[model samples]
Target: MAENKTQATGASVDEFLAAVEDSVRHRDGLRLLALMREITGKEPEMWGPTIVGFGRYHYKYESGREGDAAAVGFSPRKASLSLYGLMYGPEAAELLPRLGKHKTGAGCLYVNRLEDVDQAVLAELIKAGYRHVTTALHSP
Candidate 1:
């Protein structure tokens, strides 16, 4: 794994979302914003000027390096909304079928719009990801 040098911190979620709305230049983005709020109870965080992180987690690698990261986050890209969480590393492959339409990556899920997927399923995925990550972090 590569070093997570671009760790995100110190940015207001509201300001970040406002900037994102201005940059979106389209109506579809507005829906995405609403979905984000509906799913994540907390507001988004500006992680590295791109990612709008919802929650946070601190993880330490075997190298003794540690950092804080958004437990589950997403980024509104020009082409798609990059939802980060519930990676397909075996744990998610089975869950993807039940997740509705979308593409999954290492840890990111790509979606064109919120209308195309089930928001409740997305919430479950986020929750699973959060629980999985936190459990790993606290594990002995």
Candidate 2:
């Protein structure tokens, strides 16, 4: 099986966010860093090169592939801010409509800017995702 390429790394999250070329992205990154930390009660860590992840979960596929993934995280890409773990939230369907302008993939939520969405709604979504992913292991 191919190993997960985006495994957590020891790189400094501060250094990575500081290096973001876009000022808007840098600011948003900082906001997300603090927000995720407060939500997950876990300090941020670098996942691969760009993802700022908090907390973690281990998973094993039916095919026997297994890996660890962030319970919650986000990346401030040039095109948009990519939110991970939100897709895992049960409230995603209802929340997305209230999230303002955005897009979603199988496991990602993309936003052009922080102002484009309702921050309170975003917070609820983040909390829902974090709760779902972190507690999935204990659910029967």
Candidate 3:
């Protein structure tokens, strides 16, 4: 809706991170960057004004809307971090207990701090999201 004007996009990751602007949120962004890099070994790209995404995917809806989206991503919102998990699905349900303190939305995981959750569990969840989406991508 009104999200496109957030001024969060730029030619480079440094520029995008600079636009993010919240000090605490910035630290969490850096940590997330490192973890996503460690797991996916890909650099972050700004999906929108606030979303820092890694990897990519293409999807076609039953309604015939097709689009490309990040396979895994996250955003540092004012109140919490919204991780783009593409739907936690069956496997992800198992990791929630070990994920520490967090809340869930359709395709997002809301967390207050990186320290508030288990880093290993966070990594596992990200990996699961990637695998889950990638599997769907190849299915008939």
Which predicted model would earn the best lDDT?
Answer: 2
Q: Flag the better candidate by TM-score, 1 or 2.
A: 2
| Candidate 3: tens digits of C-alpha lDDT, residues 41-129 | 77788876668887777677676766667778888888998898634546687888778899887768899988999888788888888
lDDT tens digits, residue span 40-98, model 1: 56566667877766666777878888777876677767778787766623356666788
Which window of 10 residues has the lowest lDDT sum in candidate 2?
131-140
lDDT of each: 0.66, 0.90, 0.76
TM-score of 3: 0.84
* The candidate that achieves the highest TM-score relative to the unseen native structure: 2
Error of 1 at 59 (Å): 1.7
Candidate 2 per-residue lDDT, tens place, 1-140, comes to 89999999989999999999999999999999999899889999999999999988887888999889888899999999999988787888888899899998877999999999999999999899989888874321
Number of the candidate with higher lDDT, 1 or 3: 3
Ranking by lDDT: 2, 3, 1
